[model samples]
Each structure stands twice: as C-alpha cells, then as structure tokens.
Target: MEVAPQLRPRAGLEVVAGDVGEAVPSYAQAFQVVVNIEVKPVATVPRRTPGASEEADRLWLEHARTAAVIDDEGCFLVRGADRDWVRVRRTAHTALSAALVPGAGSMVIAMSPDGRRLCALTEEDDDYWIVVHHFEDPLM
Candidate 1:
C-alpha cells in the first residue's frame, strides 16, 4: 500500500530504533521505540464504545503534541506539530485496522511533551501494540 506523502520521513531523518516489519517497511514497529522519548499518557478509551475514535481525537486535540485519527477502514489522518493534518490510507488487514474494528479493546493515546511525536496504543486479544510517529519539527 502507498503511504501518504506527508507520513514519509523527512530528509536526514531515519528509523533510528524500531524494526520496520513486513508491513510497508517504513516505521512499522509493533512496540514502542524508546530513545529518550518522553510521553504523557493522556487517555485510554474502550474501542467498543460508541464514537471511540472521535473521543480519541478530542483528547488528542487537548493533550497531544501530535495526534492521529484512525478510522475503521484503515485511513489515518495525522496532525503534526504544526497543527496541520495530513492523511494516509492503509490496507484493512493490518493490526491497527483490526484493533479499530467494533467491539475491540481499548486504545491509548500518548504524546511527547515537546509535541514532536504521537503514540497510539491499540489492544487486540489482550495484547497491546503501540505505533509511534515522529515529526521533524516541534510544535509551533
């Protein structure tokens, strides 16, 4: 699948820590890649709840340095440090896609204090996987 142009890493930036798994070979790690990355855990909402994605987004706007909204169809709309939002579409079979399915477990949204990174934690079958995206610049 093609990743949104905005989601691509900027020049001089690389995946310094995480393993780019079979999925897309970019920033595809199932676990958090900690490299002196400090984040504030904002909220955890049950995915089974109605409008869970919306709730996540709302919390993100209030607490995140950056935030991403993942729809059930595997579409990602990410807001960077600039407060500008960009979008990407992913295949439906990915772990994130599965976790967004109705009746799935909870999702936790976290962000760096500097507003340069955003982490989304999704639960699947009692297992939680974290996907982190980093921005080249800090929040304006």
Candidate 2:
C-alpha cells in the first residue's frame, strides 16, 4: 500500500500601524528597517469585558500589533519586549508581533548572506549583535 504525503503548515509575519495615541511610548521610534519595508495593521483584539472598556488593554494590543515588519525575502523583524530584536520567518498563517526593546534603542540593520542570522544595532555604545531566527518553513 502506498502512503500519502503530509502537507506542512505555512507561516508569515503580520504588521500593523497603530495610531499615535495607541503606540507604546518610547524615546525611539517603534520600527526602523534598513531595507525596503511596509507597515500594515494585521490584527486587533476586541474589548473583552462585556459592557466594559479598558483603555490600557486596548492600547497595549495596538502597540503589540504594530511592532512587526517583513521584507520581500520572507524575513521578519520583530521588536521584542526587552527592546531587543527578534528575527523570525514570515509564515503564511501564523501571526507574530514584538513589544518595545529596552535600553536607549535598537534597530534591524541587515540579513546574513545565508539568510540565517539578523544584525541589530544597539544605541548603547553603538554596539551590535547577531540573532538567529528559526522559520517554521525551511524553504522560507
């Protein structure tokens, strides 16, 4: 008997631009990519409580939704909560977002030739670090 092949799941990044009031307060801008970039709102969470509205929760979600950016090459630049960059593969169905990085500031600089590592420039002492992000899809 012949066995059927299994289909693998797809994943990608979803980025949204939040309103100025909703964006998380930061001394530095939220997103900055050296390469070509596009910012779009990917998702939003409705007010959970019935007949209730919490501005804080709504604002937090808005900020979370705004911190992701993807390039044509399928690499993603996600700003983590600690103000560090989290690089990941751009999956088709999976939605990912990053919070503000800590310290003065940081930004994504470049992608490795092998498309495996990401370079980030930190504001403190003008330092830089290489980060490795694993993609769910090997081809991506």
Candidate 3:
C-alpha cells in the first residue's frame, strides 16, 4: 500500500476595499483564495461624556457578511445573524428584527470542490470554529 502526502491550506491573503459596495475580482492570482466583507451601519451610540462635556457618536455595524473564493479549490460565504449581529455599544439597548431573523439555512460557510462536503463556522464559548458537514443526499 502507498500513502499520498497530506496537503494543507496556506495562510489566506487579505483584500481591503474602500467601501462595502466595491467589486472584488473573481480571478485567483498569487493567492489560494480571495475574500470580501460587507457591513452596514445600523446604529449610532454616544460614548461616555468626558468631564460631562459633549459626547462623540460611535457607529455600529448591525450586519456583516463575508464571501470568499478559493479559485477552483473551493468557496466560502458566511453572514453574521441572530439579533442583528451586534448590540448598541455601551448602551443597554438590543435590536431584534421582527421580519429578518437569521436562520441555519441562510448560512454557507464553505463547499467542497467535488460538492460532497460542506463546512460551517460556529460560535461556542465565545470562540469560532470551522465545522465540516455532510449531507444525506448530494445536490445536483
């Protein structure tokens, strides 16, 4: 019997866009993958007044979604869901959408090249992780 060498992913390259609406190139050059993030400003909070003077407004992102493509190797996409993905910073207010709640089906962490395996990132104990998943029936 013979065994093949193991392969692992290199540290992914980073891309920064000036705005959330900018287009990201689909071609994978000099990198194993490419990623972009989308964020929306949902709230404005006032910081603690210094010396009882004027306070500054801090913007908060209520929703954030990230998309990634690994050329022909694979792809990844995920969104921050549940309770608007953020709370009012330094405030006791929480925003819960009555119409658009994040659900399990809307999340797509990653997909295998052969389309056999799926991956997802889950939060546990304030830590995030990649969890590979298998489907009972492979989609066509």
Candidate 4:
C-alpha cells in the first residue's frame, strides 16, 4: 500500500473589538486570531507598585472571576475561594487585553494572528492593525 503526501494547514484570522463603555469614544478594530483567551474579569494594578493587583487576586482566587485591565505585571487571579492570589503570566499564546509595554503607558493590546504573541497597537502607525501570532484554537 502507498501513502499520500501530507499537506500543511493554513492559519486562521479574526477581528477583535476594544471594550467600549457608554462615555468614551471607540478606537479602531484589530484583526487577529492566533491566541484568544476569554477576557477574564481582570483588575489593573500599578506596575512595580507594592501588591498592586492584590484586589484583583483576592476576587479571582476567592470568587473565581476575571477582570479587564490595562496592565497586569504582578497580579494574581482572585478565585474567591482561597486566600492565595493565583499568579498571572505572559502567555506564549496570543492575548488581546490592554497591557503595559516597557515604557509606553498609553498602548492598546495587540494579539498575534495565531494568538501566541502580544504587542501594543500604538507601537505601530496603522489605521487597522492586526497582530500576527499564535492563537488558541476555538472549539465551535
């Protein structure tokens, strides 16, 4: 019996939207789909400030919830059931939440097409930007 040669699969694409509240104007949309973790309710904390994300950690660990925040350098997930603050880490996969860059305080979250890398929107000067990285496969 003879076997056929295998073919490579193609990557996926997606479009993401920023959180738009009732009072603020909206920003441009980002087209990406490498990694896409659900926007857990994340809480923001001061970068390098002492125990900044403690509150967010408390809620997540004690209550099992997530929050949306700009930066999450040293915060913990508040599960609402335990006293320990579950640590958060930068994913090798892609993420699209607002985060803190090295020196840019005002940067938008940019995800890779595959959802494996993370970057900032203001880092580039494009009208409609889409970060191309490794993303988590969605089960549909």
Tell me the deviation in Å of residue 127 in model 4.
27
Winner of 1 and 3 under TM-score: 1
The TM-score, computed over Cα atoms with residue i paired to residue i, of candidate 1 is 0.31
- Candidate 2 local lDDT, 28-119, one digit each (tens): 33223222234222222232335212332233223323332234455443443344333344444442112213343433332322333233
When superposed on Cα atoms, how far off is each prediction in RMSD?
A: 12.2, 16.7, 19.2, 17.5
lDDT per model vs. reference: 0.38, 0.29, 0.22, 0.25
Give the range of the ten consecutive residues with the poorest summed lDDT in model 1: 11-20
lDDT of 4 by residue, 1-140 (tens): 11111100110112122222222111122222212343222233333555433432333222211212213442212111131111233333222212213344233332222223333322222121222222344222
User: Per-residue lDDT of 7-46 in model 3, one digit per residue for the tens?
Assistant: 0011121221112111222112101221112211122222
Which residue pairs clash within candidate 1? none
- Summarize candidate 1's per-residue lDDT along 61-124 as a digit string, tens digits: 3433235433343344332334233333333222232224334544433333333455665554
Tell me model 3's lDDT, rounded to 2 decimals: 0.22
Clash totals for all candidate models: 0, 13, 0, 45
Error of 3 at 81 (Å): 14
What candidate 3 gets wrong by more than 4 Å, as runs, is 1-108
The numbered model that scores best in lDDT is 1
